[model samples]
Target: MSSPRPVWTGLVTVVLAVAPALAACSPEAAPPARADAPVIVPGAPGQSGSGPARSPAEAGPVAADVRFAEAMIPHHRQALEMAGLAAARTGDPLVTAVADRVADGQRPEIAVMESWLRSLGRTPPPAHDHGTGDHGMSGYGMASEEDLTRLRTARGRAFDTLFLTLMIRHHEGAVGMAAQELRRGRDRAMRAMAQDVVSGQQIEIARMRGIQRRLASP
Candidate 1:
């Protein structure tokens, strides 16, 4: 009643001074201060805050992304070899045109995929090691050795027909790999490449299918 303001101020001052003493006396009075830097949990890398921080891609690509590009390189290699044969082996202008376009489009894509693998510190599969059986490629419409032999030996319209047939199957394999990457890959650039593979080869598939029908008709 007389002057509570001074009393209140004094009381606040006392509490402010005494608070640290109280906290120091009792271990449970207050929790410890948090760290400025990230806390690292032990037992495993990247478990929570373990190890140094990393960029998005530095966490490493999922198996699907790496495998997709690795498998596709030789996949495209086989396609390029087949495309190279069209000019000398086939008489149809349409087949030759498609071969030229496929080689043009895929050469850059192979370079891109190879660069991507190198960026990830991965070794891209060698062109020759990508056997038809590797990475379940047999399931993805890969051409057999016999298939290539028949195509290599085919002449004129026979070559055109076989080339289109094999090209369509090969494109189907690429589309299948791209679709798997779209489903399971985490890397954005690789996923974009996968999407391109899917879209581009689907278009080729349609074109080859149309050509196949035309060639079959009387």
Candidate 2:
């Protein structure tokens, strides 16, 4: 058994014996590739630049809040129209002044409420045409067709009387709606707005009533 000779050489024997030991020690030593995860490269931190989007409902009121806003917007629009006519038609300096103030006050409120409705993903209801013709909500008083005709046809003091009477009725309707909100509403801003409506319109109603009495006498 002299050296079963060099059939299987020393080098061949050494490779066969060492290969298993090396594999056992290494055990798949390669690291996971970088593409497999987000790289947290070292640098200054920064924001994502994108912001969370607001939902339609998140932008404004919803549910009963939406219904309230819808109803109130048209109502406020009507009030503004009435106020404008009072300003244009009335001759009594005090009545005209009040009308101007009322109109100015209501116009902005109309815009705010309408914006709120849009934000809430709601449509404002169509206003009823009270047939004042082009006069808008100024025609919304308890006055009949004949009364409105008198209002349109009259001048000076006559205009003042009709305007005050109509405005009183309009303010009453607004007060009624505001009261409804006080009773049934939950939104903080809207309810606060309703309270403002009540306070402001009530004062106007009183002023109109006084104007009516003053205009009626003699």
Candidate 3:
């Protein structure tokens, strides 16, 4: 007669035989998280704006989510344009540093939003579009063409002051937009992105204000 199977081997066989059924009955057997899911970064110490990350597979985008992405894309583009002007225009180390930070943070966010739109079978707006029509600049705090021109032309300390003032206003608008998304958007990924916008830009706004105060002093 063949030797009896070892106890450990028998237990392993039993577990293997039952594993599929166990998984089928388990709540934790949900599909793996999507790679493109938006993750909300925690806010700095003492701040209250952090949010939970969720998989894109969890929910479909609502109209609010679409609108938020469409509008924010161009809004962030304009920000990049402004940030691009910093290296050549400003002598202030603080201004240059903040501009670099803005560009660094928002550039990938724009890509994510655009990719999200494509994933929904929607076309992203033109890169040059500054969120016109239904999502106009009224509440978005976007600088006007004239404002951009002025920013383009100014140099030295003048550029630093104007850049900070405009960026503070711009950040305030983004925060407002993010807040709206949080209230009305249904997609978990979009909501996560919105929360990040709220947390990040608010911090930048405070920093910009501090820089403004420093600029104002003798």
Candidate 4:
């Protein structure tokens, strides 16, 4: 009626009235005070560190790692050979069971170590190789040929006692080797295998000791 406000005035007023509401509804609106979004702070450039995480398979093996695999392959083979003799030579169920367990556990581990060595373009020791004497693996508690011979010919409870004693010593040697690998090896897979050796063999050592005590008591 007041000559009707200018049409342009009405349009401008409408836009101004909606502007605040539009901003409030926008996707770019500020989050609430309670927002818990995670903030990722990137590392400083050229920082000296271990760098990004990698899996064991991605990591390269060091000399100690290679040595560990090489030594352990033959070590486990000897253990399996001893375990194989228990079934035919010992009448004790305990000896038989432990022998089977040792065989079952070490057989796969030998395969794993051999495959790992091959993957690294290194040759694994032969199955018959005991790595004794100048090979420098005897410190790891490997049984001597004479020891194996005595074990082979022994029978009954005598076989059980000797087997447990030798196997306990063998496991102790494995634990020591694993400790060395843990100390010096760089490959994650080999280190992990070393740890498995430590833990598994330690338990077996304790069990064998208990069997020894039982065998001694009665």
Candidate 5:
């Protein structure tokens, strides 16, 4: 045999050269997905939400899902309006921060809902007043003109108090709507979204109550 060192080096080079090709063809040798791999859940037309995913075979959206999106769009818009009022009116950093969260939270939800509507071949409805119809307080919690007027003119602690009160009521209405979606919606995506609304709004409601209690103290 020629030098053993040369033969060993040639064998090592061949193994290195073919290893990537072997791995590509060998399913068993393929790299496993990392547990920490990023999970992207598509939300709006081009966005994503968090948490587990729906089944690919999930049924198409039902009436409850449609109604949920339609009603929630306006409900969320009112919340965004209410939250916007805080920035210019409150001296409290915590109040402004909570207001920012409300607006930030609802805006993307609106986009996701609208995207669902468009995907279902429905035109997104114009932004307007929240309609209770038969659902009443269960479906939408729209602030009255008087309620909004009071908020609009309020300043200092009054604004903070009014905002917390109205928002708690608003979140309660959202929770109620989510409850209905859980009961009646068929689409997996909408149902999952509704569950999120219920869980998230409940947490916010508790936080607002705590803030309200703090405000109540002299």
Candidate 6:
């Protein structure tokens, strides 16, 4: 009988020899994504406001008011990014419309908040990254690179379903952030914005949940 050890060694050698060739024959892979995984969008840095700064005492009843606004500007911006993905990438008209509204509504607010921050003589919290800050105000629930990958890969109804679901969660976090501002904010302008966030996002949240349900039905 042939020695089992020799037979095993031969099989191992053949498998090793085939592996590199198999890898070469596979489909071409895309370049690795960044750790932060920002989507590639071409644009100049937005125009900055030269508005006057507000005193710390002028901000709100508690530190939470200022903190909420400071944290939320970036959170809202992230939500806008997800909305942009739906608008530019997805095929669903419903998704595109919702995304368009989100993008349009938030852009003006970004400017408003930037103006508010400038008035305070403080730079707007870096809108890009917020690695866990005070009072658990985590900007917003940012979708992971994996989430973006899945969104990019999905199409048609599947893409709409994923976008709506992720957006619902993202909006819910915004509601929380806005509520904190409403509760503690002293600035009338800032409080007004927070109230708008709560009202607008709540309506949109209902709309998103409806979309999710419709997509789920047979």
**TM-score for each predicted model, relative to the true structure:** 0.71, 0.60, 0.72, 0.72, 0.69, 0.65
Off by over 4 Å in 1: 1-60, 130-133
Off by over 4 Å in 4: 1-59, 132-134
Give the root-mean-square deviation of each candidate in angstroms: 22.6, 31.7, 17.6, 25.7, 19.0, 24.0
- lDDT digits (tens) for residues 44-134 of candidate 6: 3474434343454343223454466567776767677677677556777778878877877676666666555454444676766422333
Query: For each candidate, what is the lDDT?
Result: 0.68, 0.54, 0.72, 0.70, 0.67, 0.61
TM-score of 5: 0.69
Candidate that beats the other on lDDT, 4 or 5, i.e. the better one: 4
Model 3 over residues 27-116: C-alpha lDDT tens digits?
232222432334343445688645564443443455677778888998898888899999999888888888988887788778777766
- Clash counts per candidate, in order, are 0, 0, 0, 0, 0, 5
Per-residue alpha-carbon lDDT of candidate 4 for residues 1-218, written as tens digits (9 for 90 to 100): 01111233333343344333223222222221222221122234686544563443433455677678888888888899899999899888878878987887777677767766655445678866854543557677888889999999999998998999899998999899899988767555667678778887887888789889999995
**TM-score (C-alpha) between model 1 and the true structure:** 0.71
Model 3: lDDT of residue 110:
81
lDDT score, residue 145, model 5? Answer: 72
Give candidate 2 regions above 4 Å deviation: 1-62, 126-150
Clash number for candidate 5: 0
Q: What are the per-residue Cα lDDT tens digits for candidate 2 across 1-218?
A: 01111222332343344333223222122111321221121222476524453343222222444445556666566555555666457657887777676766666666556555444334455556433333323323434557556666767787787677776786786677677666655444556667777887787787778778887889
Judged by whole-model lDDT over C-alpha atoms, candidate 4 comes out at 0.70
* lDDT, candidate 5, 64-128, per-residue tens: 66677778887888889899999899998878877877876777777777766655456565766
